[model samples]
Target chain A: MRLNLRVWRQKNGGSEGAMATYAVDGISPDMSFLEMLDTLNEDLILRGEDPVAFDHDCREGICGACSLVINGDAHGPERTTTCQLHMRSFRDGDTIDVEPWRASAFPVVKDLVVDRSAFDRVIQAGGYITATTGSAPEAHATPVPKADADSAFEHAECIGCGACVAACPNGSAMLFTSAKINHLNVLPQGSPERETRVLDMVAQMDAEGFGGCTLTGECATACPKGIPLPSIAAMNREWLRARRKVKG
Target chain B: MAVSGLIMLGYLVAHVAGNLKVFFGPEEFNAYGHWLRVMGAPVLHHHWALWIVRIVLLAVVVAHAVSAYQLSRRDLKARPTAYVHRRKRASYATRTMRWGGIILGLFIVWHLLDLTTGTLHPGGFEEGKPYQNVVDTFSTWYGNVVYIVAMLALGLHVRHGFWSAAQTLGVGNARRERLLKLLANTLALVLTAGFVSVPVAVMTGVVS
Candidate 1:
């Protein structure tokens, strides 16, 4: 199969980026999207050309490392991660426009590779339990209701792929931030610091230069993990209660 | 945003209830208008409470619009470069928010000019006859067009805004979300119908 890919090419964060086109033929339908990229890189290496630099690790879809906005979508046509997306979704003579996640916080490290360390900073600000380093706690010690546990686990599935940020028109991190906040707040173990946690996390998220959520609902649609849009709302409620409690 | 937003919502509900008085005929509508101006008559002087309500509403409006504009500006700054290949992942109401807000903003100015100040009324602008002024404004084709359009925009705005405020203010959860959504849609539908009915009734010569 023949496919044309117009990918974003940038020398570094400081350099201006532009779209570069490449044509690849004789691709197998079973080849994964990343593998297809590998074939393209092999071809470029043989020609002594600067190969397209992309980021991928543990390409089994769980790592959330593969980031590509294939043909305008965060992960291509399908609602899955880029790693799991197979070449079969494309047809012959298809022109795919590939670009890195576009956001002020997510600057391009190279071609297709971005510095997602901003997410790390947001997580570092809160996205954690202040558990002391020790042996695991008894599961029966802190009993959690099935409903709360399920909701928490659902939100816990966020892979931090930056798709929510990329998918949003305003580049808002509300989904990501809310998912993190709800994941811990709903759990029994996370209740101790719940009030302070949301405040710090939301403050960090804003400090990182992310956009405010205006109930757009785009992030949830583009989310590969199927994180619900209500998570943001839940977090907003949590933030307000926490703010009021603190003020009182 | 959540605070000012709820304030506006409260005003909408009250305004709608008050507007519905027109259905009771001119006498009732005029009485309702007189009641609004003199609600706290002896205690706080005539129209004092009305002026206070106006001041609060004006303050809320400025706060809502300013915060929204600031947030929008930051969003623009966050994405200096637009997406090369954009797709629609959000809902229609979410998509139309910015434009809808602008349309509603313009409509508010027109509404105040036509009714409150009587500057844009097509027919004779009666100074105190709220019911007559409303009928005259709706009698014009352009008046009907503008009012209907603005009301529709308001409906869409409220549909999304109501649900959003619930989430922001922490008034909803997963189980109650569907209920909240239904309420949002219902509020939008009912408000749109209620507000548009006056103009529609006038155009159909039911009110005149």
Candidate 2:
């Protein structure tokens, strides 16, 4: 199979970038999207050209590193992350346009790579349990309701791929932020820092220069893990409560 | 238009309630109007305070517009290169948001100038006659019709705007989102009819 590629090429963060066209021949339909890219890069190296730089680790899709906005959809046309996407999704003569996530906070590094350290900063703001480790307790010592546990696990599935941020119109990371907030906030272990966590995370999110969530649900639509938009609403309630508590 | 819109809605409710006093005749209505002017007497003494409120509201409006513009541009960029036909799943009100917002924005500017400042009136209002200008304006069939239409647009805009802003700001839960949606729709209908009735009644000589 032959695939026409219009891949974004940027030398560094400050450099102007454009899509450079390349043709990849003899691609296997069974090959994964990353495998196809690997074949192309092999060809580029053979021709003494700088191959496209893209991020991929654990090509199994758990690392959330293989980020690309294929055509226009983040992580390609599928709801899954880019690594999970197979080349069979494209036809023999398809012309795919690939680019890095375009957001001020997630600036382009080089080629398809982007600096998603902002997401890490947001997580570090409060996306964790503050409880200290001690002697091991019984499993049911601090049991949570089954429903709450289930919901927490659902939000916990978020891989921090930055796809939600990339897909959002405002480039908001609210879905990602809320998932982290709710993942802990719903648990008994996350209660001590609940109020402080919401306030700090929200402030950090704002300081990072991410846009506010518009509830377009595009983030959820683009999310590989199916993180619901309702989690954002939960975060909002928590933030409001936290603010009022502090003020009082 | 998210934050400023919510603020504008708050102002609208108060404004409409004040205007409804006209139904009780000029003295009561004018007294109500006089109270608003007098309520700000303490702050009114300071020239900067009034400008501050105006500036803040202006800033909020600008923020709303700027955010909306950015979102609109991003939305255009999110579509895939290949054209895939998807069914229109958005609600009617949601679909008309961009155009409705633009029209409502234009109407708000016109409204502020017409009512707040007497610029829309040819000879301006008589020294003690703010309500007179309102009556005179609504007395005209064309003016009344235009006002009614604009109010209707505002009502529709607010209907969607209220819940949309709530969701955007992250205040929505399943139960609360549904309740807010219902409340917003009901308030919009009532407010639209309330404002529209005054002009229509004035035009028909039902309110003098």
Candidate 3:
């Protein structure tokens, strides 16, 4: 298949960026989106031109490192990671527009590459359970409710991709933060610090310069892992309860 | 944000119910308005109860508007550049929230000017004549246009905002999300119908 691509190119964090068009001939429909880009980059490299730079690893789809807004949708139109999106989603003579995640918190580093470390700080705020460093407790010792465990696993599916932020008009990271908050908050082991977890994590999310959630809900829609929209609502509930706890 | 939203939501529900009383004829609707002013009479001064409620409502609106504006600025700042391409996956109501909120804000000020203060009334500027005020405001075409349009905006805003606020306040789960959405839709529809019917009634001579 022959494809036309309009890719965002920026020299550096402080440089001006624009959509640069490229034409690729003789591409396979089965080739992954990244592989198609690789073909474009390979041709550029042979011509002594700087290749397009994008982040990708563990292309099998769990790694969340691959980031791109294909055409207009994050990852791609099929609701999957960019690395997993095959060229077949497009057709011959298709003009694909790609850009890095657009969020102030996640600045563009280069062509299609963005800094998502802000998510790490959001998690570091309180996305954990306090585990005792000793012999592992018996599996049966902690009898967690099945409902709680299932809910936790549901939220745990978030891959921390900035797609939610990228897709949001307000660039809110509430979905990602809520996913982390719910993943740990629902577990029995997470109960001890539940109060502080939401308070601190939400604070961190705000401090990271991410926008407040307007509940647009595109984040869950754009999420590759299908993180449920209710996750943010649940996080809201937790935040409400935590706020009312009246910490001494 | 969630708390302030819920307070305003509660107020909207009550306000709509009060508006619906217009259908019961002027005596009842006017009496209802009068009763509201005397609600906490023995314990508080006349109109003091209404004043207290207004103060609380004012505070909630300020908080909601301020947070919304601040959040909007942060949102715009977060994306310094436009995406080469973009697609909307959220509903129309969700995406149009900002504009809907602005329309509602402007309508509130106009509504106060027309009814509460009688400054913008086309008919006699009779203070405390809530029923007459309603009839007069809707009797004018522009009044009806402004009011009906604002009601529609309010409906759309509440449709998305109610479910969202409920979700944010932790009132929903997978099992209850559908019900929450249904409630949101029902409230929006009912409130819209309740508010819009008054204008329609005036135009049709039912309330006149």
Candidate 4:
């Protein structure tokens, strides 16, 4: 299959960018989207041109590193992340419009590559078990309710893809933050730092210049892992309780 | 309509509670009416204050409308060309919120002018007679009918708006969101019924 690609080209972080067109011929239908791009980059390199730069390490879609907005939808027209998308999804001679994730906090570092370090900063603020680590405790020692454990596991699935932030009109990371908050806050292991966890994570999220959640639910819809919107609501409840506790 | 609409809900509750005093006779009803005028008058008396409140309410209505407008635009931009087949998953009320809000906004402006300013009186109340205005407005069958329908629409608006705003402000859990929805619906039903009954009673000659 032959495809016309309009790929975003930027020299560096500060350079002006534009969509540079290229034609890549003879693509296999079984080739993954990233593999297709890799073929195009190979062609560019052979032609003595700078290869298009995109972020992808483990092309297995679990790393959340392969971030691209294909035809205006985050990750692609399909609900899955970019790495999981295959070339067969597009028809021959199809003009594919590819761009980097657009958000104030996720600035473009190069072509199709965004600096998503803000997410790491937010996670470092609190998304963790802060208790002293020693020998592994017995799993049954805590005896957490089945429901709470289930909910925590559900929230734990978020991969910090930054899609929620890109898709949000306000550029809010509430869904991502809430997932981390609820994941730990629901379990007994995370109880000791519950108040501080919520406070620190939320404060760090805001400090990173992300917008507040408007509850549009676009973040959930765009999320590759389908992280529930209710996670944010749970975070809000926890934040309120924490604030009240601090005040008291 | 957003701010004033909410304010009008508050006003309707107070108004219905005050009108219930009619069962106690003229002195009590009149005193209740007088108390509203006395208290609301100072804040409402100055032309500046009245205009200020109107402006603030207008701002809220505009903000609500503008937000809806931008969302609509993005929805269009997100899908410029229609899909071969599309299925909607949103509830009917959620889907029609933009249209409902537009209709409600237009109705509110007309409502304010008709009742508050006496610009378009559906009821023939002699000038300077607020009590007579209340009675005459409620007495007509058509007038009563419109009021009832408008109140029903207001109820629907509040049913969704209250919880939606809370979600937008990021202040609810699943449990709390459900509770807020129930509270909003209950408040809407109570207030709508309370206001609607007065006109029904007047039109039926149950209260004379």
Residues A1-248, candidate 3: write the lDDT tens digits: 99999999999999999999999988999999999999999999999999999999999889889999888788988889999999998989999999889889998899899999999998888988887869988988989999888888888888898899999877889889988999898898899989899999999988888877778778888999999888887888898889889453
What is candidate 4's CAPRI-style docking category based on DockQ? incorrect
Top model by TM-score, which number?
Answer: 1
Steric clash pairs (candidate 3):
A104-B78
What TM-score does the predicted chain A of each candidate obtain versus native chain A? 0.98, 0.97, 0.97, 0.96
Q: Total clashing residue pairs per candidate?
A: 1, 0, 1, 0
Q: Give the candidate number with the greatest DockQ.
A: 3
Error of 3 at B79 (Å): 2.0
What digit string (tens of lDDT, one per residue) describes model 2 on residues B104-130? 678768776676776775345554465
Fnat by candidate, in order: 0.79, 0.25, 0.88, 0.15
**Model 4 chain A poorest ten-residue lDDT run:** A209-218
Q: Give the lDDT of residue A237 in candidate 1.
A: 82
Where is model 1 more than 4 Å wrong at Cα? none
State the lDDT of candidate 3 residue by residue for B73-186, as single tens digits: 988887777776866557888887999999999999999998888888897977667898888888899999999999999989989988888887788778898998999999
Estimate, for each residue in A1-248, the C-alpha lDDT of model 1 and write its tens digit: 89998989999999999999999988998999999999999999999998999889989888778888898888887889999899999998999999999889888899899888888998898888887759988888888999899999999999999999988888889999999999999997788889998999999989888887888887888899999988887898899889999999
* Cα lDDT for residue B194, candidate 1: 91
Off by over 4 Å in 2: A134-138, B1-4, B10-105, B112-118, B121-156, B168-170, B182-208
The 10-residue segment of model 2 chain A with minimum total lDDT is: A209-218
Candidate 4, B1-208: lDDT as tens digits? 2343456556556666776676565566666655554455655673554466567766767776776676555444433222111234234545555676777777777666666788867656454445566676776666676778777776776676666666544566666867887887888788777777777777766766
The lDDT-based order of candidates, best leading, equals 3, 1, 2, 4
